[model samples]
Target: MAAAWHRLWPVLALGTALLLAGCDEIGLKSSLSPQPRPASLRVVPPTPVAPSAQSLDLARYYHKVQNDLLTRGLLRTDGGGPDTPYSADDLARNFEKIVFYNEYSSGDGLSPAQRLQSGQLSRWSGPVRIGTEFGASVPPDQRSRDQAQIDHYAGRLARITGHAIAPVRNGANFHVLVVGEDDRDFLRRRLQQVIPGIGPAELDLFSNLPRSYYCLVIAVSGAHNPNDYTRAVALIRTEHPDLVRLSCVHEELAQGLGLSNDSPYARPSIFNDDDEFALLTSHDELLLKMLYDPRLKQGMTADQARPLTTAIARELMGQQPQDPI
Candidate 1:
């Protein structure tokens, strides 16, 4: 009996040891055991890139322009400085009553009153025409393609802003010429002949006439015969003081016709928070930044952002009594 008991104890002890090993493998442990080391989690931060020098220059230019305008009383400030950021709602609200006209044909011709009021057209006259001079050195195909892009943007501007943009033809009401070349020196020399201070870096020229029509000329500083190519426009508004006061292409088109230049903000519904997001993110830079923001990941789509932004701009601008110039 003593020999049998001794043999049974060895077998029982072996079974207990096997069971304990199995429990450790399955992560089962008594409170008396030491805690296992936790798995380390790694998180990555976003990379930062500095803006280009040209972009910084542009920002400075915009700041200076705003300051100058404010000093001249051309822009109003409600306690905020001229550099105050504006929301899409502000723009929309300010210019809600403004009207926009597109050059679309209706079944009926102009009425008698409409015909008489033609001269009173304050903003735009007709379709916009853009002329390109390919210069002797440039390939005709490239020139044509560039002109096509300009035409496309013109049409887009008209359609989006509901403004009348004249087509490019010999008798077009307004003409904008874009000249391009690969050589900067040649382009500068050509533009300098027309406007003494013209430089290679400054390629865009704008002129607003008394008839409420604006003419834009863009010189491509990089092509062959850059001078002759750049001076495609024979009549330049060299002496107009207001030529320098025109806003950017988009802003000019909107303000020229007395409409709000707020971006198109579209959303399914206008909830208060959505409205706030739209207004705060109207600026192009801010909008671009918010595109990748994690907070907005579940908030809105890119398409939805524009409409919301526009509504906010309108709200911020609201209506103000304009003193006639």
Candidate 2:
């Protein structure tokens, strides 16, 4: 029995050594043993920046101006005033004429001479005129305000287009007064009235105004009738196709008169496509805002600024076709 035990002892010792080695490979001892902990990681959150007062003021100013301009006419409480309500038909007709020019010039980018006849050219270069017949009840203040807005937009237009736009005095130019429900309808009627003499050819409403000024009458009152506003813009484009490239009125005014449209802070590009709205990258918005700032207006021409503007515009637009007008 002692001889058998001695032989088995060697086997038992070897087996115990093998089990210990396997435990080391499998980390069983480490699993069972107490261990020291690693140091804690420190993480800090980013700080936020507040917007400046100047930025807030400019935003507020823009909002107030737009609201004032939009609500000018409708806010009047006096019952019997100049009614400028226009029918959809009037708008459609004016739209049709304006759209004709939009299509004509944009078709293959025709020259003004090729696109417009002598008659069309005559009307465009002649005067900035408005024809309106008010009901005896319309207030004088309302009339003045309506005219003022036109003159304001016209002056802005002139500054942008390098043309001198002045408002002709009452009864000095062709004033066609159509008795209508409101200014919108009156404008439509006036436009229709003018189309026969001016011919059906499209005029660049923006470009063709007399270097001086002209007025059109609206019997309906509200902020410049958007229908009239749009039609007038279309008419301006019809008469002067060159203005189409100068789309944004704010940018156009700033750039045309040698003002800076760029800013230091990040902002969305004015030339951005409607489709790209919220998808703009921060870098791209920063680039656009810089270009649109008024302070940067110095020593820049439209030609020089166009490439940078276009690049940022395209980036904002993403992988899409260029915007149509």
Candidate 3:
């Protein structure tokens, strides 16, 4: 019995050692091995993804609210223009782009979107008068050419908005100042003339403007109950290429008339920073028409105008005889 016990103890000890070795090989190899350390201390951020469906729904809801505030005029929707009409979707999308971007109320330090939703977008209750101010550096021939371009665009604007757009020598509400790229002094002087008493801080703001800023429009409205535009100014950089100059002219001039925001989503329209189109497309024409329509009045909040805007958009779409503009 003693001999058998000793023999069994050795066999049991051997089996126990074998089991322990198998467990170590199966589970402890990864723990014993050294892991590859990260190469550098830099940590990259994750890329932005598209807006989720819920996020898009929220955006659409906000857009609908803003559009409701845009509807206030009495003009009939069937009054079609020579240019083809756009779809309701296009009209609403462009309307959102126009109203939510491009602000001329920087003097008051209000965002374009804030001013728009609050019914602060400057409106021309009176005649829409335009004028051109040429810098001393501009040659006579070049001045003439610029004036011709301005006149042609002003006419197009008048035709599209069905408003009285006339070039005024004096008391012009909208002044287009054409300046050379290096004409910083001229730009400052004209800007001062338009917005007098702007402090050094404001001047500094303009002086340190981004290099990409080639042109801008500034429109002011009085403290009247309806918020009618008192004056407006457009600054164009003539040193840019002709196409760029033309594009600036188109965008700045149109933006001065209340659609003061640039939209990333706005395609086939000059009212975008993308430089997709050099001239205003048929889509932009429809927007201008909607803006000047008698139904939309100044001082209307987005909440107040969106319903009417929707109806007007629908009517305009219903009246379309050709393809989308």
Candidate 4:
């Protein structure tokens, strides 16, 4: 029994040594292996830049001017005001405004600032023909309405002035274009082809025109006579609000016929920039009559035309005129 016990003791000692060796190897590998940490969830913000002082001041000035125009009844949000009727006395008062304001030419590299301030009347010396061209994108209904309005206004103008104003499909010196704002690029290209010596400034004006300018009329004076308009271009926005489109149609077309500039003093008329009186009023009709009167010839200066204008206004009002000084 003593011999068997000594043999078993040797085996037990060897097994204990093997188990301890395996434990040490496992402990070394666990200590040496890498452990990954959870990634950090953080965010960083951008630094803000300050606006230029000039830009801030300009923004203020721009808003201030618009507000002033609003206060003076010169600019209206309701697309001008209702055409409140005015008496004959008001027509006399507005007559001078019409004659002087429409007497200046603004084409062929001539700026509005460069126009003659003399009381000369500017008008078409020759017969007037209006031709309308519509953008391909303009809706058919809109095109039809625009044409009807053009024809209607042309007749009205002719009757008022007793002038040979007619609507022609071809060879018209007065071109009326109806286009959407999105089609301005196409209009620019077409204009370059149609108008002789179309300048970059004109194209730029059309391309960069403010959205507020729903319509505009550009007239070119005759080369021989600065006061005689030889060509006129009228543009009307096709995709505007109904009243705005119609108002533009009335204003731009009439303006093309020589009552060009806007007069804040001219009440009950579409010739004022105030957007008051969307349609051509009776007062405007009388002014047109006065403009095309035989006595008031084209190219008469503002100073030369006032007396005659006053005379015409008095006659229209059925009032006796004072003798000219």
Candidate 5:
């Protein structure tokens, strides 16, 4: 197990795939908007070091946050039973909302989700090679456990979407970083080395990340073809509790692939901001299947995908493809 330990420096936020929270939604690449300047990455080999006091405090705070959320009956992990049922129409509508909507308006930093409905279908046109990186502060055992979770989840996503998704150690197009607060300075430098053109304002997004926000993702696509994603990254805080950390994994990694927005009406779904479901629900799996269905191609508008998704949703639920809602 390899890790990069930080020197207890400050932080930075790079731009790419959209995030689940405000930070991600602001400038994450999507078919809905003009692509950001094309950027590439250079791997920063892992280094071992100790964590700072603030990182430890952040860990304790997140544990408390997780416990409080559980106490309030949030962050469910049951995959949603009958009480949270959705309809064929619901499924199709939710799929459109999740795929074709934008969270914040035009911006450079984190902001409240504006629900700007302007996104288009965008997914990796090629294989998705997922690579996991950890901060030095993370214990070796925890790193192993986290890597296991990502590996299994990648397999689940592959099975559902029938896409080439797997954990890799080289030539990865999607990078998932599990870092703590104290490692911010190192991260800033690392990303600066990886994405040399990353702006100061963008870096401040990480340097001054709000405590309310936990994790985010960034993606890159060709300027001419917004639908085709090439490179991406997901930032998952190591401080969160087990389930919450897993929740970040499920949501952000999926978001990095394509599903870029959230909808209030999406029941039993991780795509919803309500936090009712901690993990990807059965409903989410069906959505993934529908997303990769050959009928609905990338760069498709919601209007372009509506009829096709409805029909696909029917087939997924064992109903006749042409059945009326």
Candidate 6:
């Protein structure tokens, strides 16, 4: 399956809805409005409670969901191979679409629009501190596994972007909440603190997220500088199986770093909505590296960054196109 790795791209936020052309079997493509918990900075476990009927049902549903995706050979983790070989042009084009455009309308902040609109580049201009909180129903083992994966991923992100990124317990602006159906109230209370003055419409997502949305992330920037993300929150549904949950982590957390949109042409990568890759691929790593390359400043438009992206992609791919740039 070298055409590409399998993916399960979830709606990370208002940042972008890259594409909704495919992968609806699991509804992997989303255009929700956004998160940060690199992992377990405080590790506060919710009060233990019996699993509610909704929680149990959700668990079963997600169990079947992951099974179906696997059966279809989706969520591939191999990164990609010869059959999925891509050119520098492919990289640059995908980068332009994913990094410079967004899915959904920001005008309403609540409506999920299926439109692809141009947007400025957004990313963390400062250190990214991630912390995690889990619901009571989450077992200790699951917590440990999720935290370990996030920590490892945080390190990997820092290495890839040459930026300061880490999972912390204190002073975390990025909060990752792992909750289930039973934790709706807990999540509601927490969301108030995590996102002050959140609107009722957006509130519905955290308190009563739809089954269609497997996971979600919200990356927010200060009013003075929308390109510089200051805070984020990602909701990973505990109902999902381990692989799906981790896939949510990978896509959402990375999306929090500013790759907000999904592109259909982005093969050999998780940036596509094809559900072909479960993990970030070698192709995606180059996008991250190029994103934080220092030359592409925050708030850059697609046109402003195109030349640089092409150069970066060419260098990363070691390919020279016959056509002039």
Model 4 Cα lDDT, one tens digit per residue, 156-243: 8888899889898766777787765555666786555445555566577666655434555655555455556666666776555455
- For candidate 3, lDDT tens digit of each residue in 203-321? 54344433334555555554443235556666675454455566668777776676655555655565544333456776678778877888877766555666666666666667542
Prediction 6 global C-alpha lDDT = 0.72
| Candidate with more favorable, higher lDDT: 2 or 3 | 3
- Kindly list the per-residue Cα lDDT of model 6 for residues 18-48, writing each as its tens digit: 3221121111212222344344534456666
lDDT of 1 by residue, 162-228 (tens): 4345345343322232222222233344444433343222333122112111122222111221111
TM-score of each: 0.27, 0.24, 0.64, 0.68, 0.85, 0.85
After superposing candidate 1, which stretches have Cα over 4 Å from the reference?
Answer: 1-88, 92-122, 125-134, 180-325
Model 4 score (lDDT): 0.55
Q: In candidate 5, what are the lDDT values of residues 106-176, reduced to their tens digit?
A: 54244444546466687888899998888776777778899999989999999999999999876666778
Q: Write down the TM-score for model 6.
A: 0.85
Better of 2 and 5 by lDDT: 5
- Better TM-score candidate (1, 6): 6
Model 2 weakest 10-residue run by lDDT: 7-16
Q: Output the lDDT of residue 86, model 6.
A: 86
lDDT of 1 at 209: 17
Q: Which model scores highest in lDDT?
A: 6
In angstroms, how far off is 20's CA in candidate 3? 73
User: Which ranges of candidate 2 are over 4 A from the true structure?
Assistant: 1-138, 170-193, 197-325
lDDT of 2: 0.24
Which segments of model 4 are wrong by more than 4 Å?
1-93, 101-116
Q: Which ten residues in a row have the lowest lDDT in candidate 5?
A: 1-10
lDDT of 4 at 22: 6
